[model samples]
Target: MNVVCIGSGYVGSVTGTAFAVLGHPTTVIDIDPSKIDLLNAGKSPIYEPGLDQLVRKYIGKTLFATTSYQPVHEADVVFIGVGTPSKQDGTADLTYIKKAAELIGAYLHPHRFTVVVNKSTVPVGTADLVTAIIEEASGLKAGEHFSVVSNPEFLREGYALEDVFFPDRIVVGSNHERAKNIMRELYHRLVERVSYEEISKDFAFPYNPLTPKAVYFETDVKSAEMIKYASNAFLAVKISYINEVARLCETLGANVLDVARGMGLDSRIGGKFLQVSSGWSGSCFPKDTAEFLQTSRKYGTELSIVKAAIESNRKMHEFVVEKIRRRLKILNGKKIGILGLTFKPNTDDARQTQASVIIQMLLDLGANIRVHDPKGMEMFKAVHPHLHVQYCASAEDVAHQADGIVLLTHWNEYLQLDWKQMLSIMKTPYLLDTRNFLPKKLLIGLGYQYEGLGIGTEQEIDGGIMNQFSVLSV
Candidate 1:
């Protein structure tokens, strides 16, 4: 099958590459010539664990990246994997998705049947909107020559390639039987190939002797799209709920780790995203939660709990900043060292990262900042160059000439650092572990004043400092 993927970004690149690896002739289109050139040269524009090898294997053979749209007319199936960024009103901005549809339609040859899949995360009813735009642009009626399907992606940054190859479920949202069959065929290779050895080789780990084979679920188009939104929104809510509990744990002298462990053991309440941290921030969670809230509102239903979750997550970051402000008394002239900048570890994606927000807030308060990230420094420098911040080679370099330290992102390197030695170089031995990735006892024993999201001494917990005084109905 000839497949064309619009927007060779995180989603497009990964999804397109997956299809190409499955023996389909795939071409990824993007307006960014440099990104196209990089992919053509077997250099992945993004940092994914197994993407470079995947690109290298299939770049010229079955997968091709280009800035041209001519392939849109040539392909049997076209996947629109562009970004639908959040607007100020919290609604998804569908400009990019619409443009991709428009381009696909305008260049498409008439009388040729094509399946248009919404590979990007879009609001409900967007598939209809895409169909309308394409119909208008191509001068073709829907279902006659082309059909639209809402096939949203559910990929994680660090584990995108693996997720695609071994998806838990494959949702193909289309009312057209032909379109659905086309999608099924496209993903049939994944369904047929059941190889535990391949999975173990991919992770470079021994096979779990007790683990079961992977399973894939197939569902209708609407349900599939809803699954993507609901899944992300629920995870966002889970993270926010844990953070809120962590705040109370800080006052009650209850360790959040223990609380999470107890809560996780309950079969109904599985432990995932239950770790108490500053908040959930990345490209997906924040935007998807907001979009889900807006989508609920549009459907005449108020998802008050989800809305609160979004607000709570935002406040968590501010709470961390406040902790710094309270301890330092004033941020002016204070040289603060930030341990990490990316939204998460393993991948250098800073989109909507809590650290970015916190750093901006600190800088606004007249704090001179020194930042170090394992892999996100290059990306961060591009977004925040005007700020009075120095990018350092190592965490130790960032600690030098710093009055205090903030562990924003829990990178592996940050977790492995000699905290005592790093603290000794700082002007002040103060550490704010927003992510709760550090050991509280070790830091305090080392003579450093340590603070975490929801951790403190027994006196601090019993003093009602961290407890939420007003209890709400659960």
Candidate 2:
């Protein structure tokens, strides 16, 4: 199949590259020449683990990048993986998606019978909207010349390659039976796990592939679009639920790690999103949840659970800020060091990160911030240039002369840092592990005061329930 994915952001870039690796003639199209130039030069404009290798291997051959929509007509499947960023009122701004549809329409060959896939996360009725736009632009009859299919992407940023290549379920929705079958044909080889070894040999596939093979799910256009929103919002709620519990555990002198582990053991409650952290702020959760909620209101309905999740997610940020406040007492002129700036690790995406909100709160209280990240610093600075912050070179640089340090993002490099040495350089050794990620015993043994969310803090032996347990202050 000849595949063309519009918009070379995370979704388009990963999706287009994956299809190209499957021996399809794939071209990634974007308006930005810089991104196209970068892709053609064998470099991914955005950071996704194992994506560059595939791009490099196939750039000059099966995989290609361009700033043109000329391939739309020649393509068997054209995935519109453009970004629909959140508007100020939290509705998705479909400017890019609309523009992409317009371009696709202008260049769509009326007789090709192409399957125009909505790979971007759009609202319920967006398929009809896309169908209308493409029909108007191309003067083509719907269901005859071209059909829009809602095949929303379910990729996680750090695990884009894994999710794409080994998805748990591939939900495709369209009314047209031929379009559905073609969509199935588009991923038939992958779903059947054909040539799985040859295609994935060079790529560093994400560690955990729980499902043996991908489930090919079929549904209507609107349900498919809603699946993307519902999935993310539920995951956001799950994360918020655990983080909220983690705060309670801190007071009750219970370890949230144990609580989460115990809860995860139950088949009903999975262990995936149970891990505690600063809050659920990443490329998808914040924007998607807000947009999803706004969508409910627009239709004169309510998603109360999703709304609570958003509020709870906001409180999770405040929870971390409060942790900092209680430990340091005063925030003014404090030399605060931040370990990670990205929303999550292993990607350069700093969009809607909890770190920024927490840092801004600190800055408002007069805390001088110094930060370092393995990969996210540049993007963070670029995203929030107005916020005055000292961008340090490394973890050591961030630690130097710092009063209190917070581990916001759990990057692997931050874990391997010389905590003993970092502790030595600190003016005040107040180490806050927001992710419960660092070595608590080592840091505490080294005489630096260590703190982690939901981990039992320094408290006296309170003999109440599970045996007489003496929990030392960590």
Candidate 3:
């Protein structure tokens, strides 16, 4: 099968590369000529683990990248993996998806029957919109030469390769039987191979396979689109709920780690997203949750809890900043050190990152900032060059001559550093573990004052509880 993925970004590139590895001839298209050139040269535009290796393995043979839209008519399957970013009012901007459909329509060959798959996370009724746009542009009636399906992607950044190779479930949303069968066959080999490997590590393949492999759940297009938004919205709600609980735990003399562990062991609640931090950030959760709420409003329904979660998360960044201000007394002349700048670990993406927000707030308060990130300094410097900040080579360099240190991101490199050596160079040995990635016992043993969200010592328990409760109530 020939598969063409539009918008060769993080999702499109990974999805196209995976299909190519599965023996399908895959072409990834993008309007950015530079990005396409990089991909065609066997180099990835984004920073993802295992992606470069996969691109190199199938670069010229099975996988190809281009800036032209002519490949849309050459493939039996076309996946629309463009970005639908959130607008100011929280609605998903479908301009890119619309343009991609128009481009695909203009170049589609009349003889070829193509299955247009909506791989981008979109509104519920977007598949119908895409169908209409394609029909209008191609001047062809529906079901004559083309069909639309919603096959939403559920990939995470750090573990995207692993998730693609072994997904929790494969969802195919289409009404036509022929389109469904072809889609199933495209993934049938991978599904059977995975099952065979699971049952027997060294399983032998039959020369002529007779039985049809069943691996995907077939549903309508609307449900599949809803599944992607619902899944991301629920995870966002979970993170916000835990952060709210962490705020309460700070005052009640209760350890959030213990409480989260006890709650997570219930099986129904699960242990994911229970760890408290400076709230959720990155590309998916924040924008998707807002879009979900906006969609709810459009349908004359209110997702009150989800709305509260979004608002609370926005305030959580300020909450971390407030903690720093209270400790240092004044920020005008204080030199603060920030450990990590990316939204999370293992990626260089800084979109909607809490570190950016907190750093901006500190600068507004007239503080001198020194920052260090394992892999995000170059990206961070691009956006925040005018601020009174210095980017250092290592965490120790940033910590030197600083009155306080803030751990905004929980990168493994930050965790592996020597806490004693980092504290030794600081003007004041005050450490704020926003993500709770520090060893409390070790920090205190080194004679440095340690603080974390919802993790307080016995003295803080008595002195801070009343004050926290009073503030929370207000």
Best candidate, TM-score: 2
Prediction RMSDs, each to the true structure: 6.1, 4.1, 6.8
How does residue 409 of candidate 2 score in lDDT?
89
The top-ranked prediction according to lDDT is: 2
Candidate 1 C-alpha error for residue 87, in Å: 1.4
Candidate 2: regions farther than 4 A off: 206-211, 459-474
The alpha-carbon deviation from the true structure for residue 220 of candidate 2, after best TM-score superposition, in angstroms, is: 0.3
In candidate 1, how many Å is residue 416 off?
3.0
Question: How accurate locally is residue 296 in candidate 3, as Cα lDDT from 0 to 100?
Answer: 95
Ranking by lDDT, best first?
A: 2, 3, 1
Task: Quote the positional error of residue 290 for candidate 2 in Å.
Answer: 0.5
Worst 10 residues of 3 by lDDT: 465-474
Higher-scoring candidate on TM-score, 2 or 3: 2
Write down the lDDT of every candidate, Cα atoms only: 0.82, 0.87, 0.82
